[model samples]
Target: MRDTAKAFGEGPAASIYAGFADLVSIGTCIAEWHAAVVAATSDADRFLRAAKEKASIWLKEYAGREHLLALGEIAANVSSVSTSDDGKAVLSKLAKQPLPLGIFASHPKERPIFDGDHRSVGKEKPKLAVAFVEFTIDGRPVADIQHMAPNVTHDLELHIRISRWPEKAERLVLTPLSVESATLYQLPTFKVSAPSGDPPFTFSVRERAVFSVPQSFFSRPLEFKYGAEFQPLSVEQPVEVVGQRTLRLESVDWQRNPQTGYANIDQRILRIRDELRRWPTVSQDERAICLKLLVNLAKHVGQAVQDNVFPGVWSEGQFQIEVRKALRNDPSIGSALQEHPRSAGGIGDLMFQGVPIELKVETNRTLALEDCKKFIKQTTSYAVGNGKRIGILCVLDTSPKVNPPFPMEEGIGILFREADGYVLPVVTILIQGNLTPPSHFSR
Candidate 1:
């Protein structure tokens, strides 16, 4: 059970798996239990004699009519077994005899401690890291390499799926590299059947590593999260890989900034911050925090489009509720409030850290410049009412048209609104709706 819990994060089914180590452990425990029982009982012969006398006294005082009848029957059957009769014949006759109800009520049934249902239980799978290692042809590191295909400059991509975690440490150790097409695997050079004594490869977080690969080594394209044309070695591979480690989490100092070398910061929270850096804004520090909270919203909506989750066109308010759920579901942005009341009487669609976010949906069509202008004004009002300079406006383009996806920078823009002789920018981010699948494009 311990091994099962370690391997598959399940404990209840461990009893079915009786390995050599489990038998040895069980034997040792049983031996110790027998020793303890003997010590407690002192002399076994004396203990049995006293137990028999106590049973006789209990039978004499409280034996009911049915109990007395069962005792008489058992005694007569035993007496019938003469010294001349065979042992097998006497045992067979005793087994065939019908016994009275509750005949063994005087003594409790002895059961092994491990046989109880309270022994173990299944546990939820632990949050393990999903890692992907990519090697380029030109030795230049590329961002979002998992989504991109192997072009002239870029070559083969090797993905390693590792399940084991080191004890007491949070590091995700990638197992040895393997390419099924090739015979041998080497850590350095990334070539199959390389010379022996190649140094092992080590990976670090937020750092890049370059490796040399032989020409024409990787002819076939490797599989990706969205690109399912290339089959994976195993079905248990993660859809996407993020360089995050499952460390023993400790209490964090909430007052301190995570960017300033805080040790106890969650990697997922840091990942949101990393996504915020890619967002185009003038005040990256102040306005960017709002984008961090919206990262899950954008991704969730984007995935829904990719997976064709929506059955029909949803209302603007419905989109608002869904976006609110997406943000709230994220542990990093669990405090996102929906329909927060503004000081100027009306309620903002959503509020996070005193900033208001307005949501809009364009039914059956994509969002245009005019659509953003109308919504930005409303979002700006909510921001100014809440005593803030910047606000966010998210428009869900629920268009049924099969349009090409827009780049992140193109979908996001800053619209300036002047109030009280001061200019404030409302970050308008457009989420593309009803996008055609990549497979459809191939057809």
Candidate 2:
């Protein structure tokens, strides 16, 4: 294991050091290797003598191999400092707009968002693609990037969010709530300057990887580009990713979970639950229909997963992706809701009027008792203390075997909170996907 660890780490460790040579050797960037050589450039004889001393000891201790290898690294390091720099012919100084250290000297000619929206297998999280273009419309710190859309071609801005927050963090992150598909874009860019006396600082990563026919694309970092803040350049089209899920759909069986008789005072809740199950809800049934739609919408997701009818593949996108699609695209659930605006916290998955719906996809065999307790706490906090009598919580426990008739188990979740020594009610119908094979699947 020790040898294996070193073997794996050395290649990347070496590449990182090697890639360092190009960026800083010309002093465009300040790196450790560049600093060492820069501090001694005025005294070449002294540097050569020092190198000779180390070379003698290295050669004696490990034959010529280690000595030659170290020399190669050092030589690469020195070659960079002695070669062409990125900005040798500096632009003549001029009256500059006071700006921050993060901006560049000129618009970095536009490029694609790259592999901005890909999620690889065995990763902790997907790289949520974010594109930043500086703009200050009406000179008010806020910029309505939305008004300027019709963005780059084939560029899918599934989530569109423009931010106007103060610069407070290492960086700012903005999220667009609506997920829509469009190909072209006319994004904006604003002009800003770097602070006085500092070399233009642009930390850019330009990478290209080839994914052969059967090999999946690797996870790529969030697209970070810099240009005139108000002059949002035309970004390169997003790289369309294709993938395949490894989970086999042996079969699925959808059976509605049985519910016991409800207490007399809670008949309304029971009726709402029953109405949602059998769709084509009556015109007079005025009870909050969002929850009903969510429950019914979730059915398409179960069937989709059971039959392998999804478009994108995720070694990770299996359950969550499919379920979110159902909640958003299903006509019964999405169209029936009054306001589909999304909210964080307990507003649930797809909210109707303001009720939150939480989607829990458990790898566990079923939506266990513990899952019920966990969902109750989450939905309660999301309800913000009001007796939000209509929130929904859905659970999917994916299975290995395929049931020809995919199953959907529905139940009631009682979210009780003690307020001044009295219990509060946050109730809803719970959908559980008891997916995994009943008999453990072994290779």
Candidate 3:
């Protein structure tokens, strides 16, 4: 048995460890066998059989019993004795020495430290604003305060109760309220107020979704040309007559045709000619209407011309290329144009890269003097706003030009000496002709 124990200890197989365990159980059984051997005479075999069976069962059931078996194997080898009394003495000595108590002694009971269902507020409590606490024991609700050491604020409320048999410890459940204020070190120096007053107005994300196109999209230059010889008509009132006489005379004078019953009607032609000669003097209303229509048409044409020029794309490729190249060559104009493409032409003129010009046209019909003044003021304002120094270019399209007595610099007012007058004012920023660079030169 001692040699067998030594062989088992030296073996590499895990089953050797099991064999060592069996060796220990066998030693214990041998102690029982010694008793049986001492007490029984003929039934010693039965005693030995029962002791072996009990030892085998114990070796199989005990955890880490293999380690004990290994120790037993060593002791048995050293003793090298076959007597059951020696085996009993070895077992008793091994039992007397202290053995490991294992992990069962210091094992802790598993329980949640934090109550997950309760909310805590104020100083010294859990940082979470909202939470829930739950307590239970023996598969039942055991709300006990003693078992839990909760660092709670004054605002919190604790709920406690008993749940299971054999009362172990008080289970605690904590609930927190909205904390109005909390002080440091439990000091009463500060107080907080509950949220009051109306909620602040908030802008909706959708409100800023409006789409807008840039002003540059609609910017362009407008040009108006006025032919010379325009003039203003004089206003004349109809004279009132003191008395008038109605005469009815019957003259049976007639002209007859000499051929095919058709008359030459030379006398009727003469009478019609006479009436036509007097028509202008008799029909003042028709003359007024004609004058008004002419004025309206002139106004419409001027506006239309402005509309055509301003914010208009170049229709001719040549024009577009020339303008683009010119702008690129002039540093000031090019820089301005690069910032706002719509102001390209105007910027060019303002920078003296091109000839700055303005033109206006008016028909024979006269506009109110105040209206003309207003027009001049507005045009000046617009020019100044656009960063340009402007001067008027007047054109007379009628027989005699209406020139105002005031200087053109003061306001573009024109006075006329004859009827059927047409006039226009062109506002322009003058570019120095001498400053024009060579066509080949680049800015």
lDDT of 2 by residue, 321-360 (tens): 5555655575556654432233443234445545555556
Q: Write the per-residue lDDT of candidate 1 for residues 1-443, one digit (tens) a residue.
A: 34442342222222222222232332333334333243332232332333334334434443454423433333333323223232234334434544222222233233334436566434443434345554432344434322122111334334433333322332332333232223211222222221223233233222222223322211222211212111233323332335421111112223342321322222333343433333333333344556565444455444554565544577887888788887787776686565666655787778887778788888756665446877777887887787776787888776765656654334555667766777777766676666666778777
Candidate 1 worst ten-residue window by lDDT: 222-231
Candidate models: Cα lDDT each: 0.46, 0.34, 0.29
Give the runs in model 2 whose Cα sits over 4 Å from its true position.
1-286, 294-320, 330-348, 385-387, 399-443
lDDT per residue as tens, model 3, 1-443: 33333334333333444444555565665665665455332344554565456554544454365556644444434234356655556666555544332222132223334447855442321111111122222233322211111122222121121111111212111112211122211211111112223322111111001111111101111111111110111211111111111111111123221111112222222232223223322222322222222222233223322232222222233333433454455443454333211232333212122122122333433333333433343333333344433312222221122332221122222221122452222232111111122332443
Instruction: State which candidate has the highest lDDT.
Output: 1
- Candidate 3 runs further than 4 Å off: 1-29, 57-82, 101-443
Model 3 score (lDDT): 0.29
At residue 267, candidate 3 shows an lDDT of 26
> What's each prediction's TM-score?
0.35, 0.27, 0.16
Q: Which is the better candidate, 1 or 3, if ranked by lDDT?
A: 1
